[model samples]
Target: MTLSKAFYLLSPRNFALKSKIPLRSFARGYANSEVLRKTPLYDFHVENGAKMVPFAGYSMPLTYGNVGQVASHHHVRTKAGLFDVSHMVQSNFRGKTATEFLEWLTPSSLSSLKPYSSTLSVLLNEDGGIIDDTIITKHAVDAFYVVTNAGCRDGDLAWIKQKLHEWNSGQGKEGPVEHEVLEDWGLVALQGPEAASYLQSLTSFDLRQLTFGTSAFVPIEGGFNVHIARGGYTGEDGFEISIKPLQTVEVTELLTKVPVQLTGLGARDSLRLEAGMCLYGNDLDETTTPVEAGLSWVIGKERKELGGFIGAETVLKQLKEGPKRRRVGLVVEGAPARQGAKIVEPTTKEELGVITSGIPSPTTGKNIAMGYIKNGHHKKGTQVAVEVRKQLRPATLTPLPFVKANYYRG
Candidate 1:
């Protein structure tokens, strides 16, 4: 499913009106109403007049009050916005072999990652297809914290457990690894330009020391100590705070006092797209490899040469020769082209590829999209046509991240 389609499927009844997009059937569908789960701050969302919707099997807030998606998107880009991402799965892996086990499952160089530093990594199947994208934080050589997508919860957990069992049963070098799921934990993102200042007011910790991709446990105003990671999906200088279940509501309330609006799925989608981040089910799938998805940087240089991880052969081969298709960003003129839209040669109308995600970016005020096209035609400035609403709209290939990322490197 395309990211837009997935959002539409899980969105509330009034979502079409709010987003100003016509509702249409998608080829891939998600089973809704099977059993919807609630996050720790469900009641908090309701009390604040949030429009709740079913997303990734969780009842999540789509927007707050009467704030339109474009307004929320702009708020996140200019000021600050708070997001309830508690539905995401958080887990801890520990044991003597934890590093080795994770390295085997992914292509990231976990051993070299400094303590409290995080790297975006992907879980690969045997054929190098992406299972799920994850953020792994190294607290110690034997201990690591992982965060994964909520939509892939059951499958991801099952796969990890099965692999853990298999690795534990064998006798190679390091000891058995233990996996612990942090169920009911709260993960909130304080994102945007003013995110750091708002968070600094509530804590004494030196925000300057916590650069992007690094995390630290710090005490907040209410004496609550939480893990604060200095990076977010928005490609802005922000922080993702992980809190205990019992303190979730209080911490969120404290953070949303002023300047930080309660943003939801609607804005989150646009922000991520502008940032050039991939949405799992939409931009990535079991049949897509990381290299093809434009995630080659996640693979460690040593790991690429040594070829220890699963699907390394295919990834290494692609690294050497190049992938048949490459993920690229696009600037479509006239109209916004959404997921499943066809990319074709401008004149001959020959098929090239399909759009996985697209939106009229509030930050850029232009139609932007991300998808894969034939390798040679994926270069910047290459003109192509996108089939939107049965009309071929002119488009040009551009670099990923239509907006300049403002990550605080310091």
Candidate 2:
């Protein structure tokens, strides 16, 4: 099977509810074991007794010894947590046509983006289905920095390279866009309510100046120069620091000192889910589109009016009309409705959709979930039922972000 097919098969869509397997295990199982990779902090994770597991083709930490997943989850919500996200693919796109090139690839309008501002965007296929979600940072009019999920590294790299070649040689007046993959970098996310204060102690550059969705190269303690982005997947006030591979361990060590818990993938999954973020393999795939995935905001207003990006036809149609189904939040009444659990009408028993991601939230102590539901039933407060195991649990459509996000916009 192709890698995409293999991933789709391993995804939660095919999971059996009775197995009651830990979701983390199911997520890890998606990684190909025959050719596993390691992040720069692999040794650091080992020394910390992190329970390493396969993820996105890398052997990554699941949780540290004696620190349970729920504990780590709560720590990040209350105080702070540090996560190693170095496996993600980071790249630089430069040249006079960089802005135009990126605009053609994704729906975001890069021209109006001020320097250091970043926007979440998606790479779409010809059918408008999402290839992968990414963060694009406009460093300058001629330069852009991008970070994509580790699980999509190979596919994203290939797609960008092919498109770059075409855009470079195609009918355009600007200089060719240059692509530079930054494979020698290590990324660490410092998250939670106390993240800014903790990070502020290590840098003379005012952490306050770097508001949410903005990035800047700053020197930290130990003279380590790194690109610090003031935002994270966890819907909390946080910083994602990109450092040189050789300095990864030192940077992590400095950040994980007391009050800042060392977190792993297990907690990270729950955190992002609770924060209403999508996990590529489970919550998003090649068949999903930004509009259906509730990510239409990524498309610029101008782009929507004068469509130019790939799959603009389908996307704009969905934007003008509405998607048949939409990604929405849910609150299950009983037994957490995990991925693959069917959503149906209570009395008619008509199937509406299936759950994509769900859990007994560690932060809220409630069964919360996210799934795509038929458009008419996606409105908040809509009543539905989730078939968990052999029984149906009552559920209510809730607005996304089970918890309010606390981003540092200032």
- Per-candidate clashes come to 0, 0
How many Å off is the CA of 322 in candidate 2?
A: 1.0
Task: Choose the strongest candidate by TM-score.
Answer: 1
What lDDT does candidate 1 reach at residue 239? 94
Q: Tens-digit lDDT track for model 2 on 104-163?
A: 899999899999999999999999999899999999999999999888887888999889
lDDT of 1 by residue, 228-309 (tens): 9999989888999999979999999999978999998888888999999998888899989998999999999899899898
Residue pairs with colliding backbones in model 1 are: none
TM-scores of all candidate predictions against the true structure:
0.95, 0.93
Candidate 2: the clashing residue pairs are none
Model 1 lDDT at residue 281? 80
Q: In angstroms, how far off is 138's CA in candidate 2?
A: 0.6
Q: In model 2, which runs have C-alpha deviations exceeding 4 angstroms? A: 1-33
